[model samples]
Target: MARADHWSDTEIALTVADYMKMFTLELAGQRYNKSAHRRALLKLLNGRSDAAVELKHQNISAVLRDLNCFWIPGYKPRSNYQEALATYVEDWINSHSDFDRVSQAAVKQPAFVPTGVEFSTLLVETPKPSTTIQEEHPPYSPNRAASKRDYVAQEARNSALGSAGELLILEYEEYRLRSAGERTLANRIEHVAQSKGDGLGYDILSFETSGQERFIEVKTTAFAKETPFYASRNEVSFSADFQDQFHIYRLFEFRKSPKLFSLAGAISDHCQMDPVNFICRLR
Candidate 1:
């Protein structure tokens, strides 16, 4: 029998979207430091009487005014926040969401365009292993939650990175190498491992610029700005035993914000990992 906690990809996406939209309408500015964005949305929703640009006025005041008091969960609202409200009214929609509605809503929402400000910047993380942890950890559970669509989407993001994301990662690698006085450029690297090895193909295997050899396995994630990826047992062992030539690079928040970190040397010498869910997620 399936567990109650299990969620389909569509279910997760829709739920997340519902939270996101409500988050936007009620407290996006309060929850996130989206100052300029908050102001822009207000302007868009509220038309002013200006001589130069003539525009028709759309009164969303009633809807916006009512939703203003709604609060987003999991965040403390800013004390003196200048909040923005939602446009249009949906009698049926509430705080919950379903995938079909979210897909349609996403099309109408203007794309998130970053301003020149640091808050609006796109960030990326290369990959790394870290030791510091701050809070109580949750009981480990295998992701039997990901539906086929979700699995395919997340897997695609982790691998290949759709050329554009790959290009950004390479660019960061080149810049870092140059800074370290290392000249092996990123473009020269290639994936030589056969797909579906004993299990999954090696993340990446390549030679260094100085005729040195490197066997690198990459794990890219966008979990949280501060969280390290959950390393699998196989990953820990592979890097540890093959320390002489192996490397694990972790890239986090590759799209909105990016950070890179790596672990080298015999894995056991540098890190330790738990067994429960580690081996199952090996890829």
Candidate 2:
């Protein structure tokens, strides 16, 4: 089977449509088999190999990430995608009105505290910095779908989802203390953000096994682990101030199988900071 240097427009369209179908199913809480979808897509993709098709899906994920739109978790965003990929992605979103509606509702939807998770096994490694050097994809245009609605940021600000995630960690922190034979400390755990209001920089206040203070800021998302989250200057500053005590519990896939990774010390130390919002002053 011969392969072309670039996927033709029709092939890209078919692949994007297939990916979106699975994405919609995932977001709607309906069941869809990824392998089955892949097999079905392979038939229409112009002699593209299995690996080639998978890479294209990942490239599409990268495009969606740039647009601040949610992508399928199974396909992590692979950078250096073809420029045509971005244009086709934009076309898909522009043509599909229901895509925006469904994604918006998914993020705004309320959440409940996740239960039955093995806290011990829930912690996973944080994502490492990308090593890619050359930047191929263009910067987000003002006309992009993400500029219209940032689904990732919306998920970040969903109070119900935020609270559910914070509470989940609050319980886990208490459980951790008690399991470590610090029942007294467990009883002292406080959801500071809930008790004292939101400006404290951190959400939950717990203690380490040795009774040391642990200040946690929890950021939850219903999407994949690599999904970007929003944070305030106050929270970043607070983490730097209390580096020893500060911890960020990033909970992802909250509505489904919930898991998290802990980032300790300053937030700036772990991830690149982007300024999204600004306050204006009259001169």
Best by TM-score: 2
TM-scores for all candidates: the values are 0.41, 0.95
As a TM-score, model 1 comes out at 0.41
Model 2, stretches more than 4 Å misplaced? 137-146
- In model 1, which range of ten residues has the least summed lDDT? 51-60
The models' CA-based lDDT, in order, is 0.38, 0.88
**lDDT over C-alpha atoms for residue 92 of model 1:** 17
Best by lDDT: 2
lDDT of 2 by residue, 13-64 (tens): 8999999989988888789999999999998878888899889999989888
Instruction: Report the number of clashing residue pairs per model.
Output: 19, 0
Candidate 1 residues 136-247, lDDT tens each? Answer: 3332222221111122123233334433333444454455456555765544555434333522223555556565666666555432232223454666667666677776
How many Å off is the CA of 182 in candidate 2? 1.5
